[model samples]
Target: MFKAYFTDGGNPSDLVQLARIAESVGLDRQRAEAILASDEFTREVRQEEQLWLSRGVSSVPTVVFNGQYAVTGGQPVEAFVGAIRQIMSEAKGGTVS
Candidate 1:
């Protein structure tokens, strides 16, 4: 869905079309539409926003490790692997340089 939205210029903000897409992906169309139309979606968004804020996240595309290390914004795959390796190393009482 995100791929289609970003690459194919699909409008994800269109709740009706998003619901249809959800149905195509094996979700119940009526249920998807109901959730999208209800205030529950807004509430969920707010809840997620609060959680992110509590985590000190203020941007999209954030990757965090052990709630201590993070790679915010765009990064290469090597950067992600490096973060994971560093976390694992630290977990093993080893130092990462």
Candidate 2:
């Protein structure tokens, strides 16, 4: 999906394109189309969206560590490493510089 969206220039908002993308990844095309056509999982998806929204997640690729610390948006590997170290240090009752 990421490849189709970013590399192939596929429009994710288009159901037909989405179904095609799903089929490309070995998913049943008809079932994918059927699910997209219906309101299936709509409520559950909305609920999850609301949960993230409530958690102050307003961007893509938001990483929440231990449900406490959050790193949002695209970041370098060092940023994630630092976050993990900080979270681990805090868990061990220590501090990371």
Candidate 3:
């Protein structure tokens, strides 16, 4: 799917191409095609996309930690480490400060 999207410029709306791309990733091509043809994961993906859009997400590579905090764009390694530490600390009832 990533290759199809980035390399081939394939639209996510194209189910056949999506399944073929999934197969290229070593997934079960037949099952993948069926799943894409059906309304199973498609609805879930749309819902998640909508959820992110509602949260003012207007770009790709948006990373949401535990669905509470989010970091958008291609951040540096330190930024990712900081975000992880912050999320882990919050999960353990600690604050970033």
Candidate 4:
């Protein structure tokens, strides 16, 4: 589970454990394990890392509003509500300060 990484302190020890976790979340274990062990997965992971790096996402829990306004890191419920309201307001041709 993602909670294993974020909420708890459980980190994957190896590709096997990673695949196990994926399986636990309903992914095909054998297929996921095979993919994880391949160079394709490594390249895909690296590409995702680079993509996030270019997007100024250096950490987890980053939330974006219409791909324009971003609330990074851990935030409160009110913060999310505020971002959503602002985006909605902008979409309705209303300005948000």
Candidate 5:
């Protein structure tokens, strides 16, 4: 979806483009088109959006680890490794650094 939207100039809001992207990803094109055309999963999507908004998530690429630590933006691999190490240390009751 990101590639289609950002690189391929495909409109993410268009159901046809969405269906095409879904088909490219090995999903059933007919089912994807049907779902995109209908209100299927609308409530669930809205609910999740609300949940994230409530949690102060106003940006994309915000990764939450163990629901405690958040690493936002396009971070390096080392950043993720450090976050995981910190979370693991915290779980083991290590001193907070």
Candidate 6:
């Protein structure tokens, strides 16, 4: 869907384009088209968006670790490594300090 919308300049809301994108991703095109045409996943995606909004997420590529530490936006590799180290330390019963 993202590839279709951003890269291919196709409408993400269009089921045909969505099916094509899904197929490109090695997914079942027919099943993907059916799901896109149906209202089944709409509520799920909306719920996830609402949850992100409630969590103060207003941007894409937000990374949440263990549902505790959240780092939004694209960051330097060092920043990601630091976050991972911190999360790992915490998981090992040690403080990030």
For lDDT, the strongest prediction is 2
All candidates in order of TM-score, best leading: 2, 5, 1, 6, 4, 3
**Candidate 6 lDDT, 10-84, residue by residue in tens:** 876677877887898899999988887789888899998898789888888888988768888999988888999
For all candidates, the clash counts are 0, 0, 0, 0, 0, 0
CA lDDT of every candidate: 0.86, 0.92, 0.84, 0.80, 0.87, 0.83
Which stretches of model 1 miss by more than 4 angstroms? 66-69, 95-97
- Tens digits of per-residue lDDT for model 2, 2-95: 9887898878899999999889889999999999999999999999999889989999999998976899999999999999998988888988
The lowest-lDDT stretch of 10 consecutive residues in candidate 1 is 59-68
Question: Per-residue lDDT tens digits of candidate 5, residues 1-97?
Answer: 9998789888889988889889989999999989988898999999998987788777889998776578889999999988888888888889545
On TM-score, the stronger of 1 and 2 is: 2
Candidate 3 local lDDT, 1-97, one digit each (tens): 6767789788989888877778878999999978866787877899988988898888878888887688899999899899999888878898765
Error of 3 at 81 (Å): 1.5
Sorted on lDDT, highest at the top, how do the candidates line up?
Answer: 2, 5, 1, 3, 6, 4
TM-score between model 6 and native:
0.76
Tens digit of lDDT per residue, candidate 1, span 1-97?
8775888788988998899889989999999999988887787799878987887898778987886788888999999988888898889899766
* TM-score-better candidate, 2 vs 4: 2
Give the range where candidate 3 is weakest over 10 consecutive residues by summed lDDT: 1-10
TM, every model: 0.80, 0.83, 0.64, 0.74, 0.82, 0.76
Q: What does each candidate score in C-alpha RMSD?
A: 2.3, 1.9, 3.1, 2.7, 2.3, 2.4
Error of 4 at 90 (Å): 1.6
Model 4: per-residue Cα lDDT over 1-97, one tens digit each? 5777668767766777788788988999999888877776777788878877888987777986765578898999999988888888888899665
Residue clash pairs of candidate 1: none
Clashing pairs in 5: none
